[model samples]
Target: MPSFDIVSEITMHEVRNAVENANRVLSTRYDFRGWKPL
Candidate 1:
């Protein structure tokens, strides 16, 4: 038997930052951005 408590919080600032980074990467990659999904 194991008892444990895990508490965590992620700020909106961090989430927004990660999203922005991903968008930037996507925008800059011409192949991925221009390619059509099949």
Candidate 2:
């Protein structure tokens, strides 16, 4: 059997890194082209 750990502990660098990665991925998302925030 295999197991995975969904970490509950994170550092500021990790959070910043994740946000940067998400921004990079979303930047190329066609559906997000005209998306607006509320």
Candidate 3:
């Protein structure tokens, strides 16, 4: 067995921006406009 740690060094602002961008794309993309997130 082994143990490990992962770090991205991503800031809160970066995370928020990424999420917002993804949501914006998902909501506006015609193919995904009617799709519902699970």
**Residues 1-38, model 2: lDDT tens digits:** 99998879879999999988987788779988766545
TM-score, structure 3 vs. true: 0.63
Which parts of model 3 have CA positions greater than 4 angstroms off? Answer: 1-8
TM-scores for every predicted model: 0.60, 0.60, 0.63
Tens digits of per-residue lDDT for model 1 on 1-38? 99999999999999999989987888789778875435
lDDT of candidate 3?
0.91
Evaluation by lDDT, superior candidate among 2 and 3:
3
Residue ranges of candidate 1 with Cα displaced over 4 Å: 1-5, 35-38
Most accurate candidate by TM-score: 3
Instruction: Point out where model 2 deviates above 4 Å.
Output: 1-7, 36-38
Scanning candidate 3 in windows of ten residues, the lowest lDDT window is 29-38
Most accurate candidate by lDDT = 3
Candidate with more favorable, higher TM-score: 2 or 3 = 3
